[model samples]
Target: MEPTSSAPGQLQSVTRALSVLGCFRNGEDLGVSEIARRLDLPVSTTHRLLAALVEAGFLDKVDVSSRYRLGTALAEYGQIAYRQHRIHLAEPHLEELAAITGAKASVATRHGNDAVLLGTSSWREADGHELQGLRLPLHASALGKVLLAWAQAGEGELARLPYDSGTARSISGPAELGAELARTRERGYAFNDEELVSGFRTIGVPIGDEPGQVRFALGLRGPVELMIDERVPFFVDLAKVTARKIADVLR
Candidate 1:
């Protein structure tokens, strides 16, 4: 098969470089032979691609070794990526939640199959940062469940997917998950208590009037004690109120 170029300038070079970079996802520190074999390109082509990517700061080659790893250009790209218009707009809402809850509040959306944080008011911002870009699981988080339930379309969409979990407390299988999603749709929110990571919990509501179709999320995060304790129902109500406010602003 031939690689398609979107335009003429440096397309082939870019394609080859991307292919080499993709080799890192399932494994680490690949040398020329592995990259060439995985990408099915000639070793010479792979070497040239690696050289170009390394020069462009997209890949790094450690001294005294022939292996390659991701480089600074990707980090720069990530920084650039987190500064989109939507992320900027969502900050005020995240800030409101953070101020009220005195914890981390953020906005997220489906980035492919993963939930990507778009904006945040985390506890660490006084040290000179905000939660700009972080990917979280959609299958194992309160935010993730909200995203998925919304994606389910509220019309028997619940029954179609497999809903197994990575943790013990999670719904055991897809059938049960479909039923759980049915409930989530009824309540207009979702919760995760130590589901993704032990001792971490969250309550997330969709950013739009509708669920899965919403482009953003409002999330509250803290220790499990705070989320699962008596204050949780109140916090969920707070999150829902805040979500309605966000939807009104966007509407």
Candidate 2:
């Protein structure tokens, strides 16, 4: 078997411990033998690594089965990393958009077949509820459509379609979703006219490090009265500008 670490001295122990922790997935519980088999390590070494990780609060040992799973420490660290990397980088731009338009502004990144909200900003105090982990349907929300449009270019097809309908207007077929994505590409933004929720509208533009490669989407959403047809052009322009600003910061 290959050595766990290339660094000198005790760093090897740290590498083995990390490897042990990495073996556990979101809903999986593993014993030392399974981890050792996966890592091509001996049972005794794997048991030692697991013991250290459990003691250090990186893994938790189940009382009944004696299996190991990821601990709360990893989740706490993950939230910190997510805040520093995604939310901190995108919040300023969202705030600027929300301030200019007097609506809710958000940043989302593609997660599987959904757009996962990373951060949001709103001028209204009552609208300040957290939406950090919200997942919007790819075939329904403006933010999701923008990401799907860009991803389609590389994959040569849309993500498997006919997603659960968020509203009567939500796209319900592959062909319908394909056409919407085409329109999104041509118009340089995606628009949702009460597609996700009744009486609500949103416009979203992709954020990218370069042309034609989207990393995330920036969006503005509000009541239909405030996001009427006449106001869509202005919101689209604002969303695109804010997306560009966020891309610059991320780069």
Candidate 3:
């Protein structure tokens, strides 16, 4: 169907083009027919919109599968938005976490089923690692567990998210996850025993409201030996202290 005209002299093509772009929000690669069906438009209109998006570098045509996916433009815009929104809200605490622990500090948010790194404070002289826009397992990593524990703190939040045991130390399932999260609540910390990476342990604390809709985390990552042996308990205390201090600012 021809897109309904909104105003005199306004090309309806622009409106249809936007609809086609919106189809990628489901995080799936879309074929021409799928895009057309989703937008309730004719194939010809969908093809035209897709061609425009590809030409303008807003979408890309995958030759192997003949599918269309979001292009570099969206990634660039997303990075800009992450820095402007989440990172700006998180930076001050990140700096303090890094300073107090003398370890790398990072904050992350749930992006789809994965954890997206929002920001980090790393003093190069302090042997810290880079942490901008990295993705990690939802069931692993101090960063991921902090968010999970935050979710688990709520009455029914755990049911909303699915779990997988792809990692050697992932929670195995949601029931186990709920149990672990309960422990985190009581202990005021979470642990990643090489759950995300082999032989690398991290201690993390979730930062957010009671329901644990954790949009940010205060994480200290290091070698598993140091992370678990003499350092885990010490880091746990530091994380709790760090979390309370950051919460003060967040309020």
lDDT of each: 0.71, 0.79, 0.72
> Could you tell me the lDDT of residue 41 within candidate 2?
93
Cα error, residue 112 of model 3, in Å, equals 3.3
Candidate 2: what lDDT? 0.79
Ranked by lDDT, top first: 2, 3, 1
Per-residue alpha-carbon lDDT of candidate 2 for residues 1-251, written as tens digits (9 for 90 to 100): 87857666578778878777767743589987889999999999999888888787888999899898888888799789776775687787888788888789988888777788877885464233433237788889999988888766442356455477688888887778888888988888899888887777889888873455787888888877788899889888888788888888776
Q: What are the models' TM-scores?
A: 0.69, 0.66, 0.62
Q: Best by lDDT, which number? A: 2
**Predicted candidate 1 versus true structure: per-residue lDDT over 30-143, tens digit per residue:** 898888898888999888888988999988997778889988998798678766443655568778877877657777777655677766774643212322226665656777
Q: Mark the regions of model 1 whose C-alpha exceeds 4 Å error after superposition.
A: 1-49, 60-72, 75-81, 124-133, 153-165, 245-251
lDDT of 1: 0.71
Runs in model 3 deviating more than 4 A are 1-76, 83-86, 99-102, 123-133, 153-166, 212-214, 248-251
Instruction: Name the TM-score of candidate 1.
Output: 0.69
Local distance difference test, candidate 3: 0.72
